[model samples]
Target chain A: MKRGWIIGGAAVIVAVFAWLLFGGLQKNVVFFLTPKELLAKGTDGVGVPVRLGGQVKPGSVKWNAQTLDLRFIVTDGAREVPVHSTGAPPQMFRDGMGVVVEGRFGTAGVFEATGLMVKHSNEYRPPKPGEEAHEKYKTLIQQSSQ
Target chain B: MKPEGQLNSSSDRLRDPSAARPPRTSIWLAFVSIGAVIVAQTYAILTSPAEGDMGHLQKIMYVHVPAAWMTFLSFFVVFAFSVRYLWQRRENDDLLAASAAEVGATFNGLTLMLGMIWGRPAWGVWWVWDARLTSTLVLFLIFVGYLALRAFTDDTQQKARWSAAVGAIGALNVPIVYMSVKWWRTLHQPPSSPATLDPRYTMGLRLNAIALLLVMIYFIRKRYEIARLERATEHMAEAAAMGGK
Candidate 1:
């Protein structure tokens, strides 16, 4: 009877722990927040170290080679956050690519990113025949290197 | 002089004629699996075209993904044998579970190292505290704890029972580690599958997984054999001491 009680108590404790890990502490477990979620936080989102993840807005990328300033807009369909970081992004970084940037949202309305990470999809396609794969990224690489 | 005498007797018992020798099949398996891994890796690198985005860096997937898969596979074996040990109260099952845990821990460490290598070039960071990465690290630590418990505990039956519970519980983290990306907002990409991966990369991934599976099997079998011999020697030493008393 004592053994059974001990076993029962362990099961309960494990169940509670699992629930807390997967359920009650979900917000803490999330590695990043979408722009829409961050925007929803309003003032609470500003000046706090957080990760903002979303697709890079097409045609919104502006890299200043002279100053090493990278500016891009992160969008999650509903909202967009303009991110300003000072570094060469990953080689895979491009317009419309999924990305997660770590930094604070300034009260001045730009995300002051301390870190920029490219998130690649699981797909791995080879360059099609008669098409050069490296050619497409050559300009971006050269620009970043300069 | 007394301790040295005890050690000599124990070594003699380790070479007892009654003890079973490691099977010839396990020896062949070790060589065959090692050969297969080399063949698979060479084939993968030589045949697969440069990826559209990451170029040749995509080749790292062949080793990294298979190592991670084998880590999960080994832990699953540990979980299975652990439960079996608890239910049947078999010493062999306990030994088998311990062997698998050691192999699993090895693959787990390899996976982390290879992932870091891939992450540095691909993710712009060598490590992250994301759900997937953190959970996998936790899984590795749990098994490390399981192995440590086995090493420190001298009471065979008690050690087996405690390890069985720990091993079973530790393995429960495997699925959580796998699903962490899907369940949480993480920097790590979702799990790669045939449907998600291009047709070109699938063959390489499959071959590498098979080769690694064979290697994992060979390792478990070899380790189990050594564990059995160790246990036999321990029993013999205990019997001799009791007889002397």
Candidate 2:
């Protein structure tokens, strides 16, 4: 009888855990897509949690440090998506860098990024010689550096 | 040293070969494993490239990722032993399960602490409710409870049986923890290995993982030996009491 109680209790606990895990997963899993893929999806991609990965467009970065409002464009060679982000951008965030932004696409054709992650790798090199990214965001980078 | 608790007869004392020879090899292995880990870590840190984003902070990955992997590996050992003990009811299997749980818990704590240090700058938060991090924390807590349960029980058989149950159930979380990043939205980046990391970084991670794994096995083996000797001593004590009665 005692053994039965223990087995029954464990079964219930496992069941509860499985329920919580499967239920929570529905709301939490974020879809990953590129700018081109997202645009191709039309209305299906808007108002849904998504992670957009691409290279930041050169000369499109606009940052107001005081307000912590930042704007940039993410592109996939052929297509571009305008992104508006809030709060202080990560210190290493810069133009022409690979980044994954987590948020949703607004119907207005802008990516509303709630979180920004600069993809860091040991292989990352500085912008190539004459790359305008270094010159384009120099002021914003300088302010953040200080 | 002569066996302390006198058993019913000289036959019992003579039967224990473990009481005759000290564990010199295990002791030497412990020393060698510790040294190997130290040397490997030095090589890993010195050979790694400075990351452009996290910069020098990326060096923490050598220790952090290996520690996390070892933690999961140790728990897997516990799960295996726990299931075996349940099916066979062997005391040695229970001891092995208990030993692995202790080492797994220590490595789990190390993983969590190091992850927080890496997260502070990378994610801009020391702790987050992201699925990957949260599930790992739950796994740690479950093992902790397993340890506590083992400590509070006085009956050896009861302790072994109960702990084996907890160990098996707790290990169910291990797969969930590993898949959490891919299955759900997480702040933590996906694994960087084999493909994601450059060859330069991959070398360091591989070396460090070997070192951590070696140390984990050595520690678990030493702990298992101690558990075995302890059980032998208890058996002698219980026999002595019975003889007196």
Candidate 3:
């Protein structure tokens, strides 16, 4: 009888613990905020350390070699945020690529990113026949080396 | 003093029959699995075309993914044996659980290291406290705690009972770790499957997983044998001490 009680007690404890954990996680587990979510925050989202995740808006990428200034628009379908970061973006970074940039939104409206990371999809494929991989990035790589 | 002399004689008597006969299957498995791993890795590297973006760095998946899968597999073994030990009150089950925990911990460590090596170039950082990574680290620590509890305890029955509980509870984290990416907005990608992966890379991934599975089996079997021998020796020593008294 006592053994049964002990087992039952353990089960109850584990259940309660799991409930608390998952319940708490539901509210607090936003690892990065989408641009739409961040835009909804309005002033509250500005001037705070945050990770903003979205795709680099196509045709919105601007890079300055002399200043190492990278400017891009990150859009999550409904909303977009302009991002400005110093230093080289990852090798895989390109227009229309998914990305997460870490920093705060400046009062001037641009996200002043201190760190930039590219997010790749799970797909893996070699360059198609008669096509070259890394062709577009060859100049970027050489410029970075220089 | 008298018990010491009796202990040696008792252990010798117990060991003679088994010691003379080597574990031939385990030895053969060790060689076969090691060879298979080498062949699988070589084939994976040479045949799989370079990924479009990451190039050859994607080949690390052959090792990293298999190690992670084996880690989960080993922990599942520990969980099964632990529950069996609790139900049956069998000493062999306890020993088997411990052996699996040891092997699981090794694979867990490998998974973390290989993930870091992949992450540095791919994620631009060595570590991240994202949901998936943190949960995996937590899983590794839980088993480490389980192993430590076994080591610190002196009473065999108490040690087995305590570790069984720990092993069972720790294993509950495996699913959470596996689902963390899906459950949270994390930088880590969702779980990879045949459907998710391109067809070209599927064969290499499957081959590596099979090879590593063989290696994991060999490790668990060899470790279980050692654990059983250690327990047998302990039993002989205790029985000899009682006889001397």
Which candidate, 2 or 3, has the higher TM-score? 3
Report lDDT (Cα) of residue B171, candidate 2: 92
Decoy 2 TM-score against native = 0.75
Please write out the lDDT profile of model 1 over residues B1-245, one tens digit for every residue. Answer: 34355456555655566643533345789889999999999989988999877889999999999999999999999999988887888888999999999999999999999999998877789999998899899999999999999989999999998999889878988988888888877888998888877787899899999999999999998899889878886777776675565
Off by over 4 Å in 1: A1-6, A134-141, A144-146, B1-25
The top-ranked prediction according to DockQ is 1
- Rank the models by DockQ, top first: 1, 3, 2
Of candidate 1 chain B, the 10-residue stretch with the lowest lDDT total is B17-26
Q: Tens digit of lDDT per residue, candidate 2, span B35-146?
A: 8788877887787656645556677888888998988999999999998887789888999899999999999999999989887766455776667789999999999999
Candidate 3 Cα errors over 4 Å, as ranges = A1-9, A20-22, A135-138, B1-25
Indicate the residue-level lDDT of B31 in model 2.
78
lDDT tens digits, residue span A1-146, model 3: 83586488669868965874678876677778999999899999999999999899999988877778889999999999999998877777888877989999888989999999877677778888887675334566677667
Please state the CAPRI-style docking class of candidate 3: medium
What lDDT would each prediction earn against the true structure? 0.87, 0.79, 0.85
Find the candidate with the highest lDDT and give its number: 1
